[model samples]
Target: MTAVNSSDEIAPSRMLHRLTVLIVCLVWPLIWVGGLVTTYDAGMSVPDWPGTYGYNLFLYPYKTWLFGPFDLFIEHGHRLLGAVVGFVAIGIVIAAFWKENRRWVRWLCVALLLMVIAQGALGGVRVVLSDRTLAMVHGCFGPAFFAICVILAVVTGRRWRQDSDAERLRSSTSILTPTKKLAALAISLVVLSYVQLLLGAMMRHVQPTTSAGHFAGIVSTHILTAFFLWAMTGLVWLRLRRCGDLTLSRPGGILIFLVAVQIALGIGTWVVNYGWPSFMTWVPGSQSFLVQAKGFVDSMIVTGHVATGSLILAVSAMLCVRLFHRRWQAKQDRLVAT
Candidate 1:
């Protein structure tokens, strides 16, 4: 009886861990794919808001799969993936309720599930209303949801949990110390990166052809924002190096590398569309080379961008927490040496 009880208790914990991992993995890639679909104006390809054709998910027209291939596949595929993620998120929340020991973690899991559902609803409205604003808002939500999921995964990781318990983890294991200013700068960069993501989504969602002039203006604005993003990331790295903490410094270096790669992709997109007449050639009625390249780059960049953002945010959070938490440890070490 005792053995059976122990086994049963372990089952839920393992199940919940698996579910959390599933949610985090799905959330990030889906956000990138969702961004791609939006950039291509593939959202309305299905011509139905929540369902494929007139049928539900599995019942969607077989023709969609075979005859006269359409944008419907790309768009609808994205929606179907989104639905799968939503279900997984709910499973995670439910698992949290049953398996998690902490009340706050459970509540956060519940809240995250609710947020994913709301994000799905927002996606539907973006389709039904056909509003670019709603589409941008929906796009922004994907990354935000992904970030929260990433945080949840990190908190539940064995390493993080072990660090929480080990006094050695809390000790002055670092020969180099970080100042408060460096930590603050890291936090600021993370926040700014998120804002840049929102702007990128907006630029992708808005119909530039309607007002070619206006669209061009917005594109320029987007490019400028990208430059600022690069600058901010560089500053963050410089500050971390100044702190002389290689632990933080290495991830900062990685982020800097990712940002450079993203910038190159962004410029590649412009070169591909060099002769294009309009920014949003990818919209349903008008698909062009520029549109296709934009679609591909948008897909590739957004996914990488979101994943990089998660990395930046996670690293920043850890750096800030450890810098603050280690202050007393640093002082204690100095006193003992004296």
Candidate 2:
């Protein structure tokens, strides 16, 4: 096996890494658009699968699509963006095959390709079946895919592949115990975020089909989980700061900031969707600011909340991967020294 030095091996890998980052950027907005589709109740706007009004997805008249009803515009735009992401996924897979030597990395690329395909199929099936439950499932899958993109970007980075032996020795000697705990904490945050998102999706879709009591229960769980998510994410940020690793601390700070924003957005979403909770109505001038459901500002706030939640998950996943990689490199360094 050939030894892969950073300077000698980075050019080809850099291209692949950049492509992965592009995919991550693309996926972020795709998620936001998906959220908007739900916010405006536009999931069924086009009333067809893999196409718009019986026209092939790309062949849909740009004039009509661009100038159509608001629901049609967002729904079709979401599908188009999904297709672009899918194409980028294909590019990543091809680049991985040609440029990547690591077996797991190549397979991870393939898995990402498969995931995009599955996500598209899920969206199409949701439309054809006219199933809100499936739409909720589809909604949950977008963030997971976005998280995978982030992981791929992190793993393929120059820093990840080029950890110096001296740096690893320093890291290994500094805070091995704390690193493990932070890694576990990061993983726990990801899991909790996903669960909360699922609860959110349930609350979102259940209101139209199921009873209000069921929706209320899901909302209660979602709201209660927010505090826990906020606290744990903050703890992770503090721990990372103590660990004194700038790479990890940077994203840790981002995670904490995002959690704060997400919490505020959650409250805003509630106000927009439910006309301000009764508890808040007692506040002076609160009545004047109550938001009407499905209005433009309401849609944007809710969509921003959903998009930020996805970003939080992505950052958590990236942090977890970096921490685990550092720990693994430290173990390797100890063995090499021995």
Candidate 3:
């Protein structure tokens, strides 16, 4: 909404920003592998928590896991990646506390550390109890954890750090430039998309427990949410684009692209899992299509759908933060000019 003032530039701890970026990079692949595990019903491959087949997770025989059954390889690899992310979470806080001048940012890093720990425990307990519901919960929390990492990555970077000492703008609708509406709309989209994600999880992990009628309701709701999320994302993109700020418009563009890809993937996921819908039966080649359960094409499509949903949330988080950052910096600049 406003040009970044060169005179306003401030340096942040390079190590903290680097660690934050590293975790953000690592978390997305972790989500993809987790999605794959779910796609193939490989949650129980290791049947142990914090370990692989009773061996220390890191010390587990590579020959067995690396060359083991496909499910075991993915499941164990997912655990290994999670462990690595957990360690990075610790490093993020240490770097933030040691070098970051902002007390609130340090606390955010601490919160990130705690969230990753809780998320890890959720995954482990889901394993020990063999609870699909907890598995879904774990799946749901991963995006939120990734979101915080994205937030950390954005805030710790030079763009945000440049305004390091400005008092936080009051959380109100007054700060949006050009229009006052983007703040609440962006925030709402974040929450709505997350709800859509939960409905998706219900379909993926809790379908067996749901009765036919109940499951149909969920499917209907999921479809409706996707339509609504698509429209909301479009609206946000337009607003961000019109703002004429590259930093803001770029994330908005990324969000819209992810949503478009996600919608196509969603369709592919539906077709591969359930065949053509009754409404599409009259279309060419639709009658010959058959649902392929766990087939390579179907698995990758479904897994991509899941991972893209997380990406949508992650980018949405970045845009929301950028919007707020712009508003906050604008307000600070006005105050200084006065």
The best candidate in terms of TM-score: 2
- For 28-143, candidate 3 gives per-residue lDDT tens digits of 99999999999989999888888777898899989988888999999999999999999999999889878887778889999999998999899999999999889999999999
Ranking by TM-score: 2, 3, 1
Angstrom error of the Cα, residue 313, model 1: value is: 5.7
Best by lDDT: 3
Report the lDDT tens digits of candidate 1 across residue range 192-257.
Answer: 767767656655565555487777776787778767767876777787776565656776777677
If ranked by lDDT, best first, what sequence of candidates would result?
A: 3, 2, 1
Residues 207-317 of candidate 2: C-alpha lDDT, one tens digit per residue: 466777877788888989999998998898888887667888898888878889999999888877777777887977778874555767778899999998888888888
Better of 1 and 2 by lDDT: 2
- TM-scores for all candidates? 0.75, 0.92, 0.91
Evaluation by TM-score, superior candidate among 1 and 2 = 2
Off by over 4 Å in 3: 1-10, 162-178
Q: Which scores better on lDDT, 1 or 3?
A: 3
Q: Which stretches of candidate 1 lie over 4 Å from their true place?
A: 1-14, 61-63, 66-70, 170-172, 175-178, 207-221, 238-247, 274-338
